[model samples]
Target: MEPGKLLENSELGLRILAGENGLNRKIRNEDVNRPGLALAGFYRNFAHDRLQVFGQGEFAYLLDCGGEVEGRIKDEFFSYEYPALVFTHGNQPPSCFIKKSNETDTPLLQTTLSTHDFILNFNRIITRALAPQTSIHGVLIEVFGLGVLLLGPSGIGKSETALELIERGHRLVADDMVHIRHMGKGELIGESDPMIEHHMELRGIGIVNIKDLFGVGAIRKKVQVDLVVFLEDWKEDKEYDRLGIDEQTMEILDVSIPSITLPLRPGRNIPILVETASMNHRSRRMGFHAARSLSERIHSRISQQITEDAERENPPKKERKKASPKPLMGPV
Candidate 1:
């Protein structure tokens, strides 16, 4: 696999499904029997009070006030046909068992659902289930202050070029799977996922440890990306750019990264080309655009042609036309 590839995890998911470690809890028949229980999950009933809660799933929230959800759930017992419990604010009591109001000072699940304390606890549980371990596998390249994601068909020598770049002392930000995070101002910060950090897979060879081979100086935890280079097979008929004047860009996460297409050929040293392209890209940002320079040169030659043609004909200058204003009524 190309470096930085994410693998599937079924064991942990299956374990959660197996009801291991109290991950799965069955709702009471009364809870499942309720009308909205199909839509939400379970409902909580309070004793000696007008308070009632309708919540669902492993993550549930209490309704702080009646009619919070207009026409959603009614307050009467007939409106609540599901099972629920009351418990103390912070205590972990039996959620499934029915409770008498005076029996325990602990608030029922319904009473505490809207409290900040409940939301925090519920969030913690939800995040735990969704989190997954990720790994890093390849060098992440950024150019021209624009984030470029260089993705191509596999075995196109992406890592090898990156290795060459590192040998030349350019910093290696991430290898393989880059975890790209979009900041508030639209900046894309890419980092190698921690679990698979500093590792690379080279074709015709096994996994190589980048940190061990190139040392700590070679690897960077994160960096901003600016360009994307997509390397592919060279076609003779394909019109490769003769001049570096056109600006092409690839966008990811709503941020545009300047892009270049590099053709892979036997005699071509791709690393050198990519690096030079990156340097040239940087130069363009400094206002020394090569394509614009060429275009201006062409324009200058065209202007000279017009001057030569006019001189050959030696045409006389025409008189300037004057604007004719409307005649005043008295003058007529």
Candidate 2:
């Protein structure tokens, strides 16, 4: 990310201190550093390329150091090319910090948020900006509040299925080219190409704007991919997962998401099935897996039946028939 983009997007309450010339400087990586060792004259493995963060601890340490000592620290620290330095909690840096920033032509950024809060928020932006990403030809849509990516060979009716889903009140995130990125924490965020956002290409109908026809409610700028549905031509001999007990997953950008293969054929409602799959995916995430629940219930019933059958097969015998006869004789 560029310094200007960070300034525009960061929620850290950031304000520029000096180094207007460095606003165009690019952040080399998502890694952030506290400069604890760099402050103590340990330049080895200083990670000077990463963004430097100054909190209360570093600020207090700077205050205790003599002016010359602080200057040496800064010289050694800023000698390498860094993205920028951000001070948390609106802490004004010692004059030495500013002087060195101007001398090195490095961007100096400060934030009003506390050290912990700033780190929490900045980490998220960093993760997004530097996350691994890839582009795939598919349609991303929201089904039952779950994001589903439809992938298959060209002309497999992916766009048509997505259009059917949009008609059913589901929102479309992207069509044709989906830019998917792993936004840390195992999340894959998907968005459409800026060139074709909210647009789909039908076989003969040509390109149409989904938002134009369906309005903004049926459009989404981005969505997390929860499931992947690959539509394939119906193969009469290929077996399908009729029971849903066998779950499948596909990996994209090194992140795994649930997946299913739907065989396209005549007289089949692909959109409804996709919606059902999405609802089922949500249920599994909510700990209400239908397949597992059904299996357990069936197992319990079979166990109960076996126990009852055993009791019927071995009925209890009558005890002491002779004793009953004696009692009858005495009564007579």
Candidate 3:
């Protein structure tokens, strides 16, 4: 976003302090750095690309710095290629820092929010604005509180399966081009592209508005992608996991999501399979793994049977009859 728009945005409530000429600066990344160490003459490994944040701690540290120290800090801090400096909790920046900001053509921003709150809000804003994103040809649906992405080749009935899912009361997030963004820290958010949000394309029926056909409750603006289901045309030669003992994963935007593959064939109920997969994934996350538990129980029973058969085959020999010699010796 342009540096000027940061203040004009109502949700952030940032005010421009100085460097009006730098309003056109573009913030290309989502990272926000607090310069607590930078104010203390420590510049090792300093993150110069992020927006610099000066909270109460940093401000206090700056107040304690000697004149030469403060000058050096300001000179070196503004000398880098940072986007801007933000002071939290309505705290006014020192006069010398403001002068340096103006001299270096760096934008100075102030917010009325507390340091913690402003950091939270500013980071959220920047993350959404600059998070890594890509769009894919698939359908996103929320089933049983889980987001399931259906991926397949063209004309493989992804939209048809999604339509059935919608009919089954599950909400559709996006169809036929789901826009996804990785919000860092293992979060992958999916949404419909603006131009095609709430719309779907069926092979024979043409395009349709899901929201219009299925009401507002059948659609969502966005959803976190929890599970990915890849549907493929059934191949007789390819082996598919029947017991689900070996779970699969697919990586998107550096985030590894729990994934499962479904073989599509004639008369196969894709919607039901997707629903069951969603529920099973939720169960796994809740710490109940059905496949592993069943395997363990079956193995235990088989081992017990094997031991019983071995005992029966050998007919464990009985101990020989003992004499009463011990009693007689004691008496003697």
- Scored against the true structure, residue 28 in model 1 reaches a CA lDDT of 19
Candidate 1 lDDT over residue span 79-117, tens digit each: 332222323232332222223221322123433333344
- Clashes by residue pair, model 2: none
What is the Å distance of residue 239 in model 2 from its true position?
1.1
Give the TM-score comparing model 1 with the true structure, all chains together. 0.53
Q: Can you write out model 3's per-residue Cα lDDT over 1-332, one digit (the tens) per residue?
A: 87787887777779888887888888886778888887777889998778888888998888888889887986777778678888987888999978987887789999888878877777788788788899888999999988899998988888889888899999999998898999878999999989988999987788999999989999999999999999999999999999998889999998999999999889889899999999899999999999999999999999999999998899978899987565535554
lDDT of 2 by residue, 142-230 (tens): 88878899999999999999999999899999999999999878899999989999998999999999989999999999999999999
Please, what is the TM-score per model? 0.53, 0.78, 0.80
Candidate 3, run of 10 with poorest lDDT: 323-332
Error of 1 at 321 (Å): 25
lDDT of each: 0.53, 0.88, 0.88
Candidate 2, superposed: residue stretches over 4 Å from native: 2-31, 34-47, 54-70, 87-105, 109-121, 297-316, 321-332
